[model samples]
Target: MAQTSSHVDSEDTVEYWLFPNISEDGDQLQELEAFRTRCFTFIQDQSQNYIWHEDSINLKVVTKRTAGDNPPHLYGKTRYGCNVEDEWFIVHLFRSFSVTENDVVIRIVDSDGDFLLVEAADILPRWANPESCINRVFIHVGQVHMISIADRPSSITPLPSGQPSLMDAVHIVRSMPHLTIAPSPIQEPIRQRIEKCVSQIDSSLHRCNVFVPASVAALLQSYPTLVAPAVHAFCQRDASQLQVIRAMRFFPPETRVWTSVTFTKCLYAMLVHRNYQPDHRTGWTLPPNGDPKRTGSELGMKLAVGFELLANEESLHQQGGDYSLEMDSRWNRFLNTLKEKGFFQDFLESSQPYNELLEKAREFYMNSVGVEGPAKKPVILRLMQSVFADIEKFKKEEAHLPADDDDSWLSVDPATLDQILGDKFGLLGVDDDEAKAEILPKLETFLHRKSDYEGLTPSSGRKKSRKLSHLAPPSASRKTSTLSNTSDVSQLSNHIGFDPDSFASAMQGILDFALPEDNWDLESNSSCLSSYSEEEEGGELVDKEMNNYMQTMDQELLSTDVLRTSVDNPTRKESVMSEGCESFSDVENFQPVKIDSAALESLLASYTMQRGGPGPASILLNQLNLPRSQISASKKQTD
Candidate 1:
């Protein structure tokens, strides 16, 4: 079997050994050659892709390849770059083949120069220092392990030459695969399942609701491979998932807590440093791309790189509470380490990303404590309740004290009471004497009624003691008293004497005066018109008879001369009787008077001017009421 010797100065040193499964009975050495050939072929095909999957075994591998001085070596038909392949080939070997924890191959990887080792220079084992651990990093079951030189199995046969044999060292490492720690048998499956889960996560945090299902939780309990990726995904989705994850329990409760804490701390540290080291000691590096749109595979590779650190880290196995104080202590310790290494020179502690990490950590710690910690009763809420409780207690005490009496006005200082009453009653400033005069009586009356109602009759002595100088006694002669002395209207009506004849004549004159009558119901006039219409086909006889009757009336009116009569004329009664007989004689002769049409129109116009719009009866009645001179002038013009 070919093996690479420990070389601190070499950049392309890599070696692999197959450790037989304790459960599987087989000759591992015989299969080692065949396995190497297959691996070489696989690398030849996979060297171009940094990450590739083998669907047959449900396995995935993320790697980094380099082309060094060695040229392509032909394998079958295709050429392979086996010379420059790193220990990551061993990572693929175990994972892609589904190698069990108890039995698997181990690849020794050494960067001989790793910045992580430099930063961790203080805590690294002396044997794992740059010089000694150059080719000692053993990759078993997809985890990086270190086997110290002191722990290496010694060769049974002594070498002939005094110089150490490189072949002997290779044989010792190949024979002692079991010497390094093997991961839990269940961890392989969990890693696959978690990797699959992480692969499905979308890079976008929008509407991303991550729920830690019971199945995932169970897998997480066995192997916390899910922690880093979950945190990365949920960082912008739901921070409460951090608390949910923290509450999960392993056999040692601190395992779950510390795993989450370490993963988060490492992630934050990398982000703050702005660099992601895949395997710092191996000199493999993946700088942060700042591409928030990174695919799940890219994220998984980043996660796997940091996940191995937890398994190798011995101090994280210690017990610790999830209390914020403890969490802050652990976080500060990490920061102090970084500070010592000169990492966070001008970092803003209160920036969003750092604060978000702290908030999540605080939540995890609080959730882990559940009901036992100070978080059960937040200090701010407790303080607020205490303050409100004190206020309520004070109010209850005040309620129990004796209350002031409603009738305790007598105890009040007179001047102060007077001022308060003046302000209360709106009597403090009075400018109008009339308003004051009107208000003083009402105020005095109100005070008198109040004293009576309260059954507290003020004695003359108390009244004399309390001088209300702002008020004046009510006036004795009130304007309202005059109402009682008003004279009776019954006797006054008797003194108003009335002359019966004069009253009758005045009523008669009013009755005789012309007034417009409304004929709203035209049914009577319609009946008369209809009767006249039935008497003749065209109602010609009706019209002729009505015209003759109107002419007879007009002649009688002219003969009477009453329209032109003067109040001084003594022959007014004789002239009326003679005119009546003459008017009848004139009607028998049936002679039509040739009256002036102009004069008649003038008369009608004068009548309309005096009496607005009225019927024939109303016009005749109004004509009689006109003055003697106007009636005479109209009649003379008509004649």
Candidate 2:
């Protein structure tokens, strides 16, 4: 066994051990409250476990809190005080033991009361070497990534003493749980089993699901060699699977998750403990690549590589929740740390491999859209294809960066970004000043509050709010109302790029596309289109009031001819526009215009005699009453 010693501030640094799984899994999820509760309760109830004959030892527990929590007792952590906004748990047990001195040995049992952890400072035989004793406790903690679908956020942490030395194994066996799961003892060395398990689980990384079977659980209890590799695979897999295992903590699905999802939590804890260290003067040095560490921006590049691999699981393809891409709940904490050092841009550039995804996205799109050549594109599909083309172009553009290690993007001017996008991806380029003016304010507001927003950008969220605003009061609705009394319908044609003459010409063309006749749909018709206002239902006689309503509709139809002449002579739009009438109705300036029945009749007679001949119009006129006396009376009123 090899041992190294270091001295710190007048004291010898005897040993530094990492107990990665003392509390709940995740990273260094230190729930001191839970630990204090267990410590106090164990001290109070199990006094005999800690008794060294008559010598009594005392431990005072102070609960440290964080600031983010309002009452300082609620959430993650705070600099000054704490109220935990979220709960995390971890367990770590390490201290020094000297058999040559006044030593105390105690057994700390897990919360379930099934397992006892031995705390031994048993190396002081005077002839015993301290090196071998310390090395015996160096068993690693293995981490499993996924738990189950329900709570995949939690991680699984294997105990620090998962595997032990020959002497250490004997001590562990004596205190081991006498569970009914293992009906037989393992034939191999117990220490070897544990070492194998931890090594396998910590070796690889992934983002796939996991499957834990009952048979494997019983075997894991008897031998520790399976723990490491199994957990490593679980974390790397996509989903989780949990089966009945009498040895492991087995909770029914009715009460809690049957599948284990605490692996990633424990793995993160292990990474932080092994790879990160604090330096008193020059901040700290992250784990450097290629052994002999160099300084400067190289440090940033190495750290970025590690972070990119850690967050490699794409959010787009993750199973379960949309947030499955979140490798750890404290992911932003890691980002904020790097952001402070101005290395976050490098980390983000390393996050997703744009070129790879871009290729696949392009292939998938081409197969789906069914378009052959770009030049033959139809106007109707132009807007839709522009979006598709833009998606591909942007992906390719982002795939290529200004630099590999140096970040030119960090200090780039916003105007430069817009110009670059416009030049390369014209389809996505927004050139409309009016649209930019409408969206820019909301976009900035959202980016300013970036910390609060999740799942989508601020601009998209603001647009949704704007659309929902249509439900408010009248003054809060659309600026121009089509149903308003002052809305003009005549001048609207000009605004729509149409005039009365063009509309009449279009109407003539429509009249040639299979002329409408009474014979059409006569058999299958359920309701008659020719039904008057006094039409009977179930042979019931219509009321006199209904006849009066019919006469009113006829008078309204007479004024429709006033609109007909306006349609026949499109030049009237200029004169009407000259009168200062702008709305759809323009009731003040043009609504009072009366229909000239003589002139309307004359116009209809001329159109009926023209080429395509009034085949159906003559038959339609034969059914109406046009008495000369009524026309004379109308003329007298006009006079």
TM-score (all chains, Cα) for each model: 0.19, 0.14
Q: Per-residue alpha-carbon lDDT of model 1 for 1-639, expressed as tens digits?
A: 222344323444332333322222454323432343344334333332221111011111111111122111111111111222223333354445434333343443333442223322222332344455543444454543434333112322221112223333323334554433322322333345435433433221111111122223233333232354333332332333332223222111211111111222233333233333232333222325674323222333333332332221211333333334455554454344444543333547764333333333333233222324234212221111222123233334434433221223225585676456445433333334433233232223323333345343322111221233223222111211221111121123334455343465466557645431222112222323444565576685665555455445645765754434322334333333342124233333322222233434455456434433356522442322222223333333444
Cα deviation at 252, candidate 1, in Å, is 65
Candidate 2 lDDT, tens digit per residue, 1-639?
111121112121112212212222432233432332233233223221211111122222122222221111111110111100000011122111211111111222121111111111111111112332232222221211010011011212221222233233223322332210111111112223334433443232211111222222222223222233233323333322211111122211111101112222233233223332222232223335554222222222222222222222221123323332135434334334334434322433323322222222232222222323321111111111212222233334433422222223335586676456444323242333332232222222333342434223212111324432332323223211211111122232334453333465466566656532322211111122223322566332343344345445545654675545532434333333231113222323323222334443453444234322345332322112212222222322323
Cα lDDT, all candidates: 0.32, 0.26
| Candidate with best lDDT | 1
